[model samples]
Target: MHNSKNSYIHTSAKIYGSTTIGENCTVMENVILGYPQQDILLQVTSQGKQIEDFEFHGCDIGSGSFIRAGTTIFSNVRTGSRFRTGHNAMIREKTVFGDDVLVGTNVIIDGNVSIGNNVSIQGNVYIPTHVTIEDNVFIGPCAVLANDKYPVRGEYHPIGPVIRKGASIGANSTLVPGIEIGEGAMVAAGALVTKDVPAWKLALGCPAKITDLPERLQSLNKI
Candidate 1:
């Protein structure tokens, strides 16, 4: 199959069957789109899961998107228009990314994730499965978001963290699964987020604790 004039796929990139790229998109060299899943880790987990929800096939990319070099986007992923990813990124299957999203380089995004519009995830971030990131959010570089709380034989289905709209996560912070980050909240750099952060608050320290919003942001949106 041939790509339209509105779209450009580099010669070195490999696009598998059942995937569709929209108009005005540029996929750079060595960028792999719509590759099948291995799911080796899920196989080792409890076997009798309802397989339909986790189907892995291919993907659909929206118009005016830009995929950088060496990015591997797994099958069954879908993204809206104006989506951009940095080089050497890993976006797994069963993920949905909204419009105008920016994913930085060396980011690892697992399956079953949902990212809202106008979100920016910086470089070297790790996001596990079952996570929901709301709109207008900013995740700093090197932030690690986990999913599995108790890894005892994977007895239960894992649920990742929920980042509310307009939230900001600082660099090198670690987020435990199943917690909620309130809207407009800000987490400090290198903090370990264990609990829920209230709306418009600031969180800091190893086990993140809420503080008054910074003077700069507080005046903008007082709560």
Candidate 2:
């Protein structure tokens, strides 16, 4: 394989067959690509079957995407252009990320997820499977996105959450599943989001409240 200037693939890095990396991309040290896994499990799986091993389909790094040092991207993850990440970020399989996305350090993103463009995901965040994040959204550090509203032993069906467009979730927050956060809404730090958040409102506290709207959206009151 050929190497380009301004693009660094560390000697310690291991890349497997048929991988495509765009121009001006930096693949740092100790990065591993194309781990093995069971087919179509990342997409969806039925019960009574155990996930045996970790597998990778392939990874596509878009142009100008800077993959920081020690970051690991498991197989079948598709990422768009101008993507950047902090050190030691771990992204699991079957995930799709759009252009100009910024992911902070020590972030953990699992499979069956989709993230839109211009999103900012802070450090130490845990994003579980089957979640969808729309465009221009902000997810703060240590935010926990929960998929199960109620857990029962006999019935073990997991459903992931969704963070809508232009929504800003403050640091250390928790979003319960089966709820939609409306466009341009804001959730304050440390709040537990248990319900659907209305558009252009600010929610805070243990169960979250509509304190006020930000100035940008406040203009609607004038009309």
Candidate 3:
């Protein structure tokens, strides 16, 4: 039962000896941390660096954020207070999640991304790098946002699409890179976004096309 001045860790949790935990946070039981292992399959990276920085390994977890059991927060990640993620979620490095963000189970958040406050990302979502998810955005389950249209073999840059504020990406949808999903836009389930989506427009299909409507998209129209 080791003790720290400003952090809380449960005795049942088996974190690696080299892992560094931050202050004002709770480390739950049965949490397995495999750090400093190069060939491990669950290699999560952040900010173009390996998740290895001991100090500031994770960002400021706000006063009220409750991270569920089995969640892995990679290195170089800086998030605002009240950041909550579901069980077994993987938040990759250098990602900034704003206050009151909720990421559901089995979600894979890639590196160098920015998630705004009050956003809810449903289960099993994949967010690649250079993607900006603005405030009040709802990303449903299995939503995959791709950043590279023509991904090269050994080149890495700020690639991928932009998801604007108040946008709702449906379940099982794919967002192609370099495109901008306008503010208040709605992408239907299973749609493949290949081009720019205008603001307040509803798009759906294999090669997603815009749908014209009188009233702007206020909320997610469930499929």
| Ranking of all predicted structures according to lDDT, beginning with the best and ending with the worst | 1, 2, 3
Number of the candidate with higher lDDT, 2 or 3: 2
Q: For model 2, which pairs clash?
A: 35-55, 35-56, 36-54, 36-55, 37-55
Number of the top-ranking candidate, with lDDT as the measure: 1
Better of 1 and 3 by TM-score: 1
Candidate 3 structure quality by residue, lDDT tens digits, 16-95 = 32444434666676544432332232444434444443322233345455667887765456567666778888776667
Task: Give model 2's TM-score versus the native structure.
Answer: 0.84
User: Which residue ranges in model 3 land beyond 4 Å of their true spot?
Assistant: 1-8, 14-26, 32-58, 152-158, 214-216, 219-223
Candidate 1 — worst ten consecutive residues by lDDT sum? 48-57
- Model 1, 14-61: lDDT tens per residue? 876467888899999999887767662264245654333333456788
| Runs with alpha carbons beyond 4 Å of true place in candidate 2 | 1-6, 38-56, 151-154, 216-223
Worst 10 contiguous positions by lDDT, candidate 3: 33-42
Q: Which stretches of candidate 1 lie over 4 Å from their true place?
A: 39-57, 152-154, 218-223
Clashing pairs in 1: 6-24, 58-76
Better of 2 and 3 by TM-score: 2
